[model samples]
Target: MTNSLPEMAEIWQQTLNWQPSDHQQAQFQRLYHLILEGNRQLNLTRITDPQEFWEKHLWDSLRGIALKGEFITSLKEGASVIDIGTGAGFPGIPVTIIAPNCTITLMDSTRKKITFIETVLTELALTNAKTLVARAEEIGQQSKHRQAYDVALIRAVGTASVCAEYTLPLLKQGGLAIIYRGNWTEDETTGLENAVKQLGGVIEAIEKFTTPLSQSIRHCVYLRKVATTAVQFPRATGVPTQKPL
Candidate 1:
């Protein structure tokens, strides 16, 4: 049986004040097929059910960056974006399909996953996106990649502090990082504030929303880079997650 994702146009408009264009919708469908095929060999993702995949993987991924409809606008103006630890291309592929004007780099530590995403990009005919095989720690320090992105996206990667450390070092001044989380707490926010500050970033906003399909609580923490990060940032490999700022 071929699982088909729901084309909930009304829900997309109601929740995000946006709807996918015809080409984008078709691209999403093709992406679903590619991912399912890739899964057979690569263990791509656990979300195979169509509706569940639509809600959790596609919707949740976009929601992190869709603050009051700003994400769409930014992409329209051709922003540079990066997805750190983009397992199976979660938000990155969806964003690449929806925002054809923006350039997207999907970065992951695993060579096989990046290899799979490279296929996904080619199959989707996505010219504005690319794949990177490297850990966030190493990429954050590279002179070519450091402070190079206008937006950074991370989800299910690590603790908020570690996410901050990984993301902030790669953002240009005034760039934004969207950290996706399932549940959030004020205490966690307090801790994140200190961590972001140490990385030359500040908490711009934290939005809490419920999933339209499952009513699951979710949070998106927005961090803005206000100054240049110290060169010592991102530490060594595994340092961010082990010691976290």
Candidate 2:
């Protein structure tokens, strides 16, 4: 059986404990069609089953919405946001669907992914979002993007330490960098503490939850950028991954 927009949305509302407006429902249908169309041209995603889409894609994306009251309040009022390594628009597209006020930059290093994202945005008429094809380090240093967003989000991109270097430089002071990690251990958190502090951020909270279908454990490591990052901190393109703090 195929899961239509209304069916998927009901699952979202039940899983996330929120209602979707009519406009949001329409946006879901748009996304469903766009993703299906894009899948034919390119390997956009492997989870083609509608149930898998609901669990992995929609619910995973809506997990951010669970934090919308606090972690993403700024996005609800027209704040700028960037989704680093937004392959196939995991959290960015769904976040845009729910929070129309946010202006999101969905960025990825691969041209094909950005092409897929741009195509979806155009087909869905999502005017509040844009695409950027660049590495995180390069985008961090660009005059237009540097320190430009209220919040930066990344999912399964890299280690917390390395992801901090890629994401923190793009946020203004007092902004948040939310990193999504799966099954994070205590040792992993301890290992990243120094890197977080070195990057002018403090570990705020590590929220844990279970995915709707798979029941997989997920972790959201929230860090607050308390001060500005040093100009030399990112240390050129690809440095963070090569020599993580």
Candidate 3:
């Protein structure tokens, strides 16, 4: 099953207007295998097929930043990034691979998953990334982590309000939070705007795009932090999911 993943260099340029370097391509291939090997011991991810993994995990992760390409590149070299609830390191690992200068924190509440990611890091020699095993609520209130990141990435976590509560608190003023979702609606957008307003952030943009290979609908919500988030946010463990904002 060597080279199970299709090399879609032209497709990437056509869709995202960018393609990975040769080394980045190799790293992506390595990451795929690492995740596959990890699944046997842990329930890291269910999308194991090469094509599925390429579209959902690898391509989809970078697609968010590709939408805000110029703005994301404006972030200083060595910018701090946190991937909250980064299960199996989707988006985080891909971001790390692409942005070699940025320092990425791959955080997940599950210890086994973090352990598996740690191995992936070592195997990939992904020195720019680090793994953290902690909940978003816990870190959002911590002195060292609160308002410490330039970018926060979250995917498939919870509701829009819950995502805002969990991510807005971790971003420095002027920082950006990119939330990935499958399906979105006008009502959801209204609610999300209110939630982020309460958290000292504004909805900068809500980009809807179809996936390159499958043509699946996806949305990338960009929240820009304008002021300090209230201290009550992230609101105790289970509170964000249970009560949201």
The 10-residue segment of model 3 with minimum total lDDT is 67-76
Candidate 3 at residue 69, lDDT?
A: 43
- Top candidate (TM-score): 1
- Residue 58, model 3: lDDT of 91
Please, what are the lDDT tens digits per residue for candidate 2 over residues 164-189?
A: 89888899988888888788899888
**Model 2, position 46: C-alpha lDDT score:** 86
Candidate 3, superposed: residue stretches over 4 Å from native? 1-3, 68-71
Which candidate, 2 or 3, would have the higher lDDT against the true structure? 3
Q: Quantify all predictions' global Cα lDDT against the true fold.
A: 0.91, 0.81, 0.89
TM-score for all models, in order of appearance: 0.97, 0.92, 0.96
How do the residues 1-245 of candidate 1 rate in per-residue lDDT, one tens digit apiece?
37777898998988888889888888888899998999999998999988989999999988887986546466778999999999999899999988888999999999999999999899889999988999999989999899999999999989999999999999999999999999999999999999999999999999999999989999999999999999999899988888876
Residue 163's lDDT in candidate 1: 95
Flag the better candidate by lDDT, 1 or 3.
1
At residue 162, candidate 1 shows an lDDT of 96
Q: Pick the candidate with the highest lDDT.
A: 1
